[model samples]
Target: MSGADQHIHIEWRGGTCRVKWWSGEYLDNGRKRYESKGGFTDEEVAFNHGRDKLYEIRHGTHVKNRDGATPMSDWLDDWLAAMDHGHLTERGYRSTVENHIRPYFKKQNASVADIDVLAYRAFKKHINAKMKKASSAANIMMVLGMVLDDAVPRLIKTSPVERTRRRGKFVKKPKERKKDMTPQAVEQLACNARTVFGQAGYVFIWTMAMTGMRPAELFGLTREYCYPNWPLSDPRPDDEETERYEEDVERYGRGDNLMPAIRVERQVQYADSTLQFFPPKYESCRSLVVPDFLAELLKDLLASHDHKWVFPALKGGSLGAVNFDYKYWRDVADGADERSGPRTRGARPAIPPVPSFKGRRLYLLRHGHKAWLDEDGHSKFATESRMGHEVPGVEGVYSSVTVPMERAIMKTLQERWDRLRGGSSGSDA
Candidate 1:
């Protein structure tokens, strides 16, 4: 071997051929780095292996030994630490790693390079077997894919996880639209909530149904964020928000002409066994307009409570996310009976189950609010903005919620409430 052939060296050792090839990488000491393989009976086989390795190096698809040696757990830790995520998102990622990823890979003692297509498929099988919910399994797989993707070109040449689009007849069926609570059903739920949690609960149910604010946003609502106070109580706007703030100030100063609104800037998050205030998911901070009826309801509720939070726990202070459903919400939505433990003397009557809300999560109220907005034929920009969702593309950039849209929303919502109330009164007659 001579000239260009010198880049690859083949020698016979104990009647078997060994091959070494320059990796095209240089050491700090001005020396050429080389990689090798052994135990080939034929010299041509060893030479071909060396040629393929050299090709990979030149194409930048080679995974160095030192980089590939990193353990999956260690790599996951580094990947998670480098991610820019909100507190809740970070917590969720950590949970997925600790609860699913670590346990499965721990037995294999897998390294960064050990996970190939077969290994990833095996892991997916294991995840499916362990997780009851398909959604949970999918989420874990997504996190694992992301972690591996971040390691590309460094720890591994490419991620083993492959995402294929469902094509033709294999495409997923459109999801069934979620059921929305009717105005009368919402009223029934609120009355039930009032029985279970007093006036605060009554107002809480109504607020969620009317505004579509997320459960966390409602949980974290402070006195200053509620009607008649927000926007005014908020700190002075930064430079970019100056114009909007001026417009809001002008509108607010218009006495009875003002359409009530709440600012959704923060949410209550539970972490490390303590409740903390964090920005709403995706930091979708926006002002939500409310009907006059809801404004009066909020005013009365605010006057009733001296706590910092607009809606405080029965025992006082911020509401706890843990066991909240088991303790209070289940009774409110599912209803309580003799089996719900002995009723204390002077306790409110057993809550009758709202049929529509049965077996449903509290978050559905927000969904129902969106449904109501759609039913009333509100503008897409106004409805999406109200729901804390950004409309995509050029439309979102150019369109915005104007005063007329806000006023229209408020009027429709107020009318819905009044109609429900009038029906209830007529039934009493």
Candidate 2:
């Protein structure tokens, strides 16, 4: 990734001294170093400077950043902080350890080039000690490689890890998730809903099963973006185009009779305790086609709620902490049997305590919807768009494009759901 940096720049403020500028690597934050050759008066000078610095930084032969070298733990700590700024979700932070990063190299003091091959090779053996799934191990390897790869330009540290780490068939890929709502779990949770926090949480879970959007996308949803009724739906509301949304929604499904299929354009996030607006996760925004049942649900969800959001309110509109802490939600799900909805009519059975973690992420709905589509033989373009895989370069190219359709994709998914419900493909629910 390097061979792109050069050490030279100019100051734009004072053209006479404009030639005086920043270049090369600077040791940063006690032991870590960052690629430093940018602030230049001329664009070419800055580009050339950073470009060469990346080469030296990644290759690990650079003179400027020798002091930044440290144990793997220190570098990873810095990496975690840096990733906090970039990730749209906490997956980056949580999976790093749970997926087997700490077990092997947590103690090693890694230089740029050395950490790539040998340490990782040892990690592979270490991972096999605990991880039974090949795909899971592969995922850990991928995260390690990506972190090292990022060091290429800024740290100019040589990473033995390559972008692609396909090492034989031992590294099996993870099975794609197809089950959005298992019948037992859904029934148990629905039964528990009425007795606790009312119909709201159940409806939220139902919304996930019915519509294949993510939790953030659901939370960011507003009445203006969703409702087609008078007042709230009125465009150009109070002038100044307070409508940061609906530009594209109107562009596609415009006017009074607009059938707004939820399109994720932006999200409200609480970072540094500040409410910030940014584009949706997976980078590219998409529009999903909801079933007619889900459409009715959305209409009710919009009309019934006084809250600004479709889901229940939490002060700042971010659910980062609430996601992991499912005790409150678990209590609701576990106690739902005694509650009354349409069918229960009260005097329901006593339900058991269930793990709330699985129910927490609304994105599980995406997997369920994709499975149904795959069974129904939907197009690949439709599937990819729904998943929102718009990242660039390697992952983007692989993800955005639809691979050849598999024959078993439908049969397997449908059969699994059927088995869960104690029914066959031809049997009625």
Best by lDDT: 1
Candidate 1 runs further than 4 Å off: 1-4, 165-180, 237-240, 320-322, 338-346, 424-429
- Candidate 2 clash total? 26
- Structural similarity to truth (TM-score) of each candidate: 0.91, 0.52
The local distance difference test score of each candidate is 0.84, 0.52
Candidate 2 to truth, TM: 0.52
lDDT of 1 by residue, 57-147 (tens): 8788887777898998899889877978998889999999999898888779999899999999999999999899999999999999998
Question: Which residue ranges in model 2 land beyond 4 Å of their true spot?
Answer: 1-86, 89-158, 162-196, 229-257, 268-270, 273-278, 288-296, 313-321, 328-363, 374-379, 387-429
Q: What is the alpha-carbon lDDT for the whole of candidate 1?
A: 0.84
For residues 108-129, what per-residue lDDT tens digits would candidate 2 score against the true structure?
5455444656666777677767
lDDT value, residue 272 of candidate 2 = 63
RMSD list, candidates in order = 3.0, 13.4
Q: Point to the candidate with the largest TM-score.
A: 1
The window of 10 residues in a row where model 1 has the poorest summed lDDT is: 420-429
